[model samples]
Target: MDKIINWGILGCGNIANKFATDLQTVSGSVLRAVAAQDLDRAQNFAKKHTVERAYSNYTTLVNNPDLDVIYVATTHNFHYEHAALCLAANKAVLCEKPICVNAQEARKLVELSREKDIFLMEAMWTRFLPAVIRLKKDLDSGIIGTPQLVQADFGITKPQEAGSRFYENKLAAGALLDLGIYTINFANIVFGSHPERISGYAQFTNQGVDQLSTYNLLYSEGRQALLSAAVALPTPHQARIYGDKGRIVIDDFYHPQQYQIILNGKKPQQVDEIFDGFGYLYEAREVQQCLLGGKTESMICSLDETVAIMQVMDDLRKQWGLRYPNEN
Candidate 1:
């Protein structure tokens, strides 16, 4: 029988709640503990999730020897600090997306994880979804026949309040990090290569963070991706992949349940997938398998890929004159 993997969560925020709830669906895994800055919040989350323990401090949570891995679900600005803390404690980590504010921090965390020889992965849940698996398999099978141009967008209409995490520059609030990463990762999945040239534009909030942004990624041989993300602006949240011989469309590329495939001289086909527990359990299961296999990282969402994606975002932010509070 496989050893049951124990889990802990750092930071009891909205994303944390989703992850905790979905974690219950992962087989051979247990939510051993959770921690938040506030004692009350931690206790409440623990109770809601039926977790074994809760602590007000992250250090206490990370030091819990029973936990095999910890998920860092804090805001963007705190990911590097929290993930690094876990790694320092010799705890495996599954950090939230956009892993760090910049590539520099991501590289450092990657180095530390390697040094520790502990499992670590960016919780890119989409990469583990059955739909995405099917999509990749179909693409590799030449169903799309040489994807040429990709168009994708992710946007959420949030109120422009500086106090909210969505608009707070201190929290590293920006559409590029929060929503745009989805579009960027989608392009990465389709192309399986980094863009040779990246150009971007953004609309900034009063707090100096991007309210909305668009990126154009030019790959070799004229392949390209046009993508956008927003906090204030509304978009269709759609994605399209155009190839020399066919095309595919996804209604919600971020967490798609269905997509349409249209090929030249062939009838259009629709693919649909169903998943339980908010789609996060897939990544959680990946973490469990990596730990069980004694692997330090997941190839599907490798640390190198995470760092590379952060570099792309860093370049786009630099071009837009956007910098978080901690950057040089």
Candidate 2:
């Protein structure tokens, strides 16, 4: 327990690379191993990141007793299965966003993590970003008094191609799960509650996945959040929270480093946050701190919250008549 905490990565994808790169920035962490379904990709990632071990199979990586925790960075479909594997092995997990394709799977993973007495958290990295930290504080302090409405948009234009990951039903690919979740999470962060009434619509691709999803969420007392996301168009990747007293605006909010506060009668004041890397070190540090403190869940991104977000996605998908192969 005195030595640095050993970490293992369960996917060798691009997101895993970013996590590995930032893991080095934290003082009490070490990337002990890396794994992928593809052995060659695993070895290459290990070599590039200078990890100590690489494995083609995820179970082998999780079974390693030296590892203190594992990061689940695989595609959406694999998140619940991989995280459950790690927890069953009595290893802690920091699974990537959305937790799973559906709330049922997410809840099962959470239950297993609790049953195994190991840590589990959704890697909702945006919550741990420097700018968001300040934003949370201001909101809590009533800088934005009684948030009445919130708005956010995330859209990326991609060439429509059959079986593309963004529109492939087999992969659980859809604008709602991939991009809309961010906007949903942002609303949750601001309102600190789930929407009571959920209504949304999605434009489906030929593959039967959501190409563009837009919706309005109604919280308690008629408070609302307007959210939109698309894979076929470019929209502002920004968020705004409006309260009686003022509003907070954040651009590129998912990994934001700066945000603005505009009061009712005052000029806009900007708050800039400084970070060394892509700003993932904050969450990496959070994992280390939780392990060191013997905590099983993250305060920043709880298991319940992850499941709630997935439930919203499920409802949205249902509203659009979109269903993945496995779900059927």
Candidate 3:
């Protein structure tokens, strides 16, 4: 019989709800509990998701021995704290993307996860999507020859209301963290390595958060990536990989459902993928497999790579002279 993996959500926010909805789609997965700062909100989420338990305090949820793992779905600012709390309790963690605000906190979490001998992975859902998986496989198969460049952009139009997490520095709100991460990670998967040199420019809001940003990365062997992200604006949200022999284009790379490969002297070949729910089940399934197999981390999205990705963002923030309220 397949062993059930019980999950406790560390935050009852919008993302948590989406994750919970998708978790139900994976076999042998249970939405055991959920926790939020407010008791009323936790109860509401619990009722909505049919979660077994709900807690107002985070510590209580992390300490629940029945939970085999915890998904830290909190805001960017509290990711480190909430993930660390779950890790310290010896619970496997699937943290939301950007893992932490910067590289320093990411490193600490990586070290702690290793010390605890628990599973840890950044929920870079793009990495586990069927379209992305095929894209990487096709690239490795040499169908595209040598990839020379990658281009991707992600942006959203959010209302710039007071205290909105999309525009508040205190909430660690910014396009780079909230939206740009998809573009940067897409480049990482295409290049198979972090950039050797990073240069970027950012336009900030009056709240001192990045409103729009663009980054150019130089990888080894002269490979390059041109990426951009923005909030309060709309972008193409497309991704393209250029190689000597051909190129592949994904209409919505971050949550892609299809991609087309255009090879030299050949017709464009298109591949389509379909999945149920919000497409988050792939990552959750990975976590379930890892736990059942006694694996401590995902090779597709390793803790080391998570830290490296964080470092890349840190370098970009340094270049742009951007820092959140909690950073030194």
Over all chains combined, what TM-score does candidate 3 have? 0.98
Q: Cα lDDT for residue 82, model 1? A: 95
Q: Tell me the spans in candidate 2 whose CA falls farther than 4 Å from its real position.
A: none
> Comparing candidate 1 with candidate 2, which one achieves the higher lDDT?
1
* Model 3: per-residue Cα lDDT over 1-328, one tens digit each: 9899999999888899899999999999999999999999999999998988999999999999999999999889988998999998899999998799999999999999888899999999999998889889999998899899999999889999998888999888899998888888899999899889999999999999899999999999999999999997898899999999989999989989999999988999989986668999999999999999999999999888888878888898998889997788
Taken over the whole model, the C-alpha lDDT of each candidate is 0.92, 0.89, 0.92
Worst 10 residues of 2 by lDDT: 160-169
From the highest lDDT down, the ranking of the candidates is: 1, 3, 2
Better of 2 and 3 by TM-score: 3
TM-score of 1: 0.98
In the range 208-313, model 2's lDDT, one tens digit per residue, is 8888889799999899999999999999899999999999999997878889999999999999987768788898888889989989999898888888888988
For model 1, name the residue pairs that clash: none
Candidate 1 per-residue C-alpha lDDT over 196-247 given as tens digits, one digit per residue, 9 for 90 to 100: 8999999999999998999999988989999999999889999999998889
List the candidate numbers ranked by TM-score, top first.
1, 3, 2
Q: Stretches of candidate 3 above 4 Å error? A: none
Query: What is the lDDT for 293 in model 1?
Result: 94
